[model samples]
Target: MNKKLTLSLDDQVIRKAKAYAKINNVSISQLVETYLGEVINDDEPKLTGVVAELAGIIPDQEYDKMEYLQNKFS
Candidate 1:
C-alpha cells in the first residue's frame, strides 16, 4: 500500500534530490520513503548488565588500534 504525500521544499534542494535520484537510479519519492522509513524505525539497542554499566566509562578519544591489539595479544 502506498499513500500520496505533498512536501514543500527549497527549489535547490529539490533539484539536488532529483539529480541524486537520477544518478542512483531511484525516484525522489523512493529516497524520501527510505529516509522516512529509517527515521521512523530507528531504534537503539538496549544494553544490559556489565555492558550497560561500562557504557561511556572510557572518555571518547582516538587511539592506535594496532598498538592496542599488539599489546593485548603479544
Candidate 2:
C-alpha cells in the first residue's frame, strides 16, 4: 500500500518539474516518488562502490570530462 504525502515548492520549480514530467510522459507525483525511492535504496550504494572502483582504474585525464560536468552542475 502507498501513503499519501503533501509537499510544498516554489511555483517556478513546480512548472519546471511538470514540464520535465510531460516530456518524459509521467506525472509529477511519479517523478517525485521515483526520486525519493532512489535516495532510500541501499543497492545504489553498492553499485556506486563498484562504479567508483572502476573509475579509479581509469587515468585521471579520462575522468576530466566527468569532473568538468560535475563542477558545472555543482
Candidate 3:
C-alpha cells in the first residue's frame, strides 16, 4: 500500500535526481522512499560508560591525513 506524494524541488535537483535514479535502475519515488525510511528510522546504538564519557572530549579539528600516514610509515 503506497500513496502518491507531491514534492516541490528545484529544476536542477529534479534533473540530477532523475539521472541518478536512471543510473541506479530505480524510480525517483523509490529513491525518495528509501531516503525517507532511513531518516525516519534513527536507531543508532548508544555508547556506554567509558566510551560515552570520552565522546566529544576532544574538540572537533581537522588534521592532514597524508602527513600523519607518511610520518607513521616512513
Candidate 4:
C-alpha cells in the first residue's frame, strides 16, 4: 500500500536531496520514504550482532552481475 505525501522542507535541503537522489538513481520521494520508514521502524540497532558487524567489512560496490556471468560462460 502506498500513500501520497506533502512535506515542507528548506530550499537548500531540497536541492541537496534532489542531487543525492539523482546520483543514487532513486527519486527524492523514494529516498525520503525509505529514510522515514527506517526511522519509524527503528531497525538500525539490530545490526550490532557479530554477523551484522561483518556487513561493513566489505566496501560498498556496484557490479554488472549479468555481464560477469555472461563473459564467464562465453
lDDT (C-alpha) at residue 16 in model 3: 100
Which consecutive 10 residues in model 1 have the weakest lDDT in total?
38-47
How high a TM-score does candidate 4 get?
A: 0.56
User: What is the C-alpha RMSD, rounded to one decimal, of candidate 3?
Assistant: 10.5
Ranking of models by TM-score: 1, 3, 2, 4
lDDT of 4 by residue, 1-74 (tens): 88898999999999999999989999988998898888899955556578786977655787687987999999
Better of 3 and 4 by TM-score: 3
lDDT of 1 by residue, 1-74 (tens): 99899999999999999999999999999999998887788797667799999999776997888998999999
Error of 2 at 1 (Å): 1.5
Per-residue error (Å), model 3, residue 49: 28
Give each model a TM-score. Answer: 0.61, 0.57, 0.59, 0.56
Per-residue alpha-carbon lDDT of candidate 3 for residues 1-74, written as tens digits (9 for 90 to 100): 99998999999999999999999999999999998887788599667799999999765797787987999999
Model 2 lDDT, residue 7, Cα: 95
Clashes of each: 0, 0, 0, 0
lDDT of 4: 0.85
As for candidate 1, its clashing pairs are none
